[model samples]
Target: MVAMWSYSAGYNVVEVGDDVWDLIEERTLVLFNHQSTSDVPLIMAAFNSRPNLSNNIMWIMDHVFKLTNFGIVSWAHGDFFIHGGKQHREASLLELGSHLQKFYIPRKRKWLVLFPEGGFLKNRKASSQSYAKKNNLPVLENVALPRVGALKVIVDNAAAEQHTDDSDKIKYLLDVTIAYPGGRPLDLPTIFGGWRPACDTIFHYRRYNIEEIPKDEETLTKWLYDRYEEKEAILQEYYDTGIFPDAHTTHDPKFEPVETNRLTGQRVVHDTLEFILRHIFYIVSTWIWMSFLYWVFTSICQLVW
Candidate 1:
């Protein structure tokens, strides 16, 4: 459904690295900047583009999202929901940590996507800027200050837990920067309206090994702050120059276009078959719903007459 939505919306995704998919195959934590609800479909499209990366993904989202249709689907996917209210914030974090410890096995291949900023950049920008001013931190333009508590808990637990083998012990962290150059922010309404961007959506991926990150909470918090600061700089550069710094570019030789089936032999054919199956499923579902409604209407009319 996500792939079909993305394709129908005319979302052209340009990924920086091929190795990022390999990292995902390993137990990897993916951190991305939150822009809009459309980010979910775009990210799903990114994972779907690669054969190595499975769409079996989990997300860390706030309780408010659980009220939406997206939230219902996410719930089915086993996503962790955290309460954002001040009263239950600490308790929620603790619960989230415990859940992560139990849910994510070291040997399993999982992609845990985290929006460390906690909310959309546009909504949180003013508060983030005010906080930065007070703390002498750099004023973030593109992204907001990341709430590190959840990150700290996840990293600490992952580091402390013992894996089956030495290779499995080290998990990769991919800092993915998603950008829509010369385009408006994407939302559900925009997508439903079939609004296509003039330019392609660019996803910049940089990998960080788990062993490279500090395990201690305090240092790790600072590390996350530093990472966001770097993100801010990268975004600032993009806005000014209309291109990201070449130093951050991932020149993956194996990277191929979505239309190309060379990377995975039967990918294009498989995707076409999946698309057809999805349409059939939708058609059958609509027919069932309409038939039930019609039966109910006829039963009511017969009783009244």
Candidate 2:
């Protein structure tokens, strides 16, 4: 469904990494920059382009998303939802950590997607800028300041889990940065209406092994901020110049792009056929219902006369 929607909307999603599959094969935590609601479909489309990456995947979503139809599906998929407000923030993170620990199993390939920015960059830019200025940090234009509390909880719990069972280790932290070339954010309505953005959607993925990250909360918090700072630099560069520099670099050599030719062709054909069949069914059903209504109306008129 994501692939069909993206392709139909004329989005050309390109993922650059050598070991994309290996990243998924490990106990992975995916951190991505959130731009718009369209980011969900775009990331799903990327996973769809690869084989088996979409399986055993879960997302950390804002609690408000759970109120939508997509939220129900996400809940069924074992995704976590958190209230981002000040009142429920701490409780939410604790609950999330508990859920992660509960669901984690040794040797199972699982990927948890997290957006540490807490909200969309555009919506939080003013506050981010103010906070950065107050703290004497550089003002970020592209990415927002990452809230580290949730990440700290997640990492601590994962580390504890690993300590209890050495086999249940977190393999890598995949830092994914998404950029829109034309600086226009894609929304659902725009995508469904086939309003293609001027440039292709690009996703840059880099992996940091768990051992490389610090165990201490303070150090880990700094590390998380540094990662977001790097993302800010990359995105700033992208906006300044219309290209992402050296986007294909990866830490692992074993990552190879899956053979997508066969899968893509089969999917395109399948989606097209399904679309046509659906329209035909809708048209026939509507015609039948309208015919029934007309017959009933005529019969009632004759009885009254």
Candidate 3:
């Protein structure tokens, strides 16, 4: 997907945070802000250089997405396609909990990626604000108030006391904030059709040990909201100043920003290499599928004739 984006237009992805790659190797719960449908390419491009991390991660996505473009491949990779809306909400979360307990460790997944906002920012922002207004919480504009049900489900299974082996459970909380150029997000059309002046996919990452995060329902709910609040601040600052905060600016001891682009320097070799291999596989598979269809059609026509 990133390759296709790059091929269409030289889309660049920037990664910011400490120069540590340890969290990528650990059993981590990664939460991303849902901004647009085009976000996946950026995430893929970010970790594409590290195949172990990118390839081994499990995604939590909408059930309808299970029938979309890359849905079949996601099925092959064993990602959880969760149902959406209030009607299926409780059952979906229960199913998610069951899915995690059953497959998270057994399938050897290192990262569990979630968008706790439950939907895209544009779609959920109004309802999120209304809920905030009713509950006397801060009205967030940049990011939605995260639904804690999935987060609770994750922690209860992945970080709770159920696992006998400490090494097998989640050890870190990865907060990834995605930003597009000038606060303008790109969608599937923009990525596929490409754009002039190129589009930048900026990713800001912050990691905390699972021990530092709250595990209980109430505290964890507040903890999740607090993170979204921080995300709103971070995004606001970025939109206003065209740059994110550093320690001196935000007084955050955990933030040590080191930026890198995945498409530049020696990484270009890695990206191009993967691009060719991915395209080749897709092309060959598509050809084989077409051949089978052609054979079936020809046989039916012959019988009719």
Candidate 4:
């Protein structure tokens, strides 16, 4: 994976807005839109080169990553395991979450990446309304599926540690939506092709600020619903204006909403199923490769004896 992206004919991936970077300096939480596989790596590579940013960046890697050829790629960088599931029982995996949070936690709050969209996608967008609704329940969201495990953990942990409504600690959040100009969407092929030369692949990131958080659940729900509606409008302006998306749309409540990729049961099911299959293959391939190496080593030892 690194080889592919590293060898790309022309590296067009660039960070447009400094809102996220600026906010992080003041201790803020950022919920970014996940569009392609390159999202995390691109973010890591983008910030890794920055000498001034001190926040320790970490990402939750699924269990199957241990099996992939690129599994080590993630680990060597800032890869982490999603809380619970296959990795939860593994003591080392469970320990990593706490360890990383502390490791990355500088003198102040850390600059972390949370993929609230869960996994990379083409057109799917889950609003803040949906997230708050799910938070009302004790069960939380799907287990194996990626929702906002990292975010939930951050909130819960903060509340537990501070023994206060740490929710208030989250003074700001940037809702980053990655959109492609020229009416195109990102896909696996183009993601892989991201390593190659491409003129039409520019992705525009739109940032929105969560200006307020309701004190109660009911107000929070309404706030989230209104927030996503606001997000939809900002996306349209991106098409209308060539100027990069920023935190300018919040002041206008009357902005028109754009048609969205409606949420569906089929899309949810597909994402979960695909994530499972990817991990299964990862584990199986990892086991096979490990076994092969073990056999080769034993065979050589016996020959020498």
| Candidate scoring better on lDDT of 1 and 4 | 1
TM-score for all predictions? 0.81, 0.79, 0.89, 0.53
Give the per-residue lDDT digits (tens) of candidate 4, residues 90-145. Answer: 46443644644554342244455566544544433343335446766322111111
lDDT of 3 by residue, 137-242 (tens): 9999999999998889899888887799876799877788887777888877777787556856677777777777777899989888888888898889988998
The local lDDT score (0 to 100) that residue 217 gets in candidate 1 is 77
Per-candidate local distance difference test: 0.71, 0.73, 0.78, 0.46
Sorted by TM-score (best first), the order is 3, 1, 2, 4
User: What is the Å distance of residue 295 in model 2 from its true position?
Assistant: 23
Give the lDDT of residue 284 in candidate 4: 95
Clashing pairs in 4: 8-195, 61-80
Between candidates 3 and 4, name the one with more favorable lDDT: 3
The top-ranked prediction according to lDDT is 3
Q: What is the clash count for each candidate, in the order shown?
A: 0, 2, 0, 2
The CA lDDT at 171 in model 1 is 73
- Any residue pairs clashing in model 3, and if so which? none
Ranking by lDDT: 3, 2, 1, 4
Best by TM-score: 3
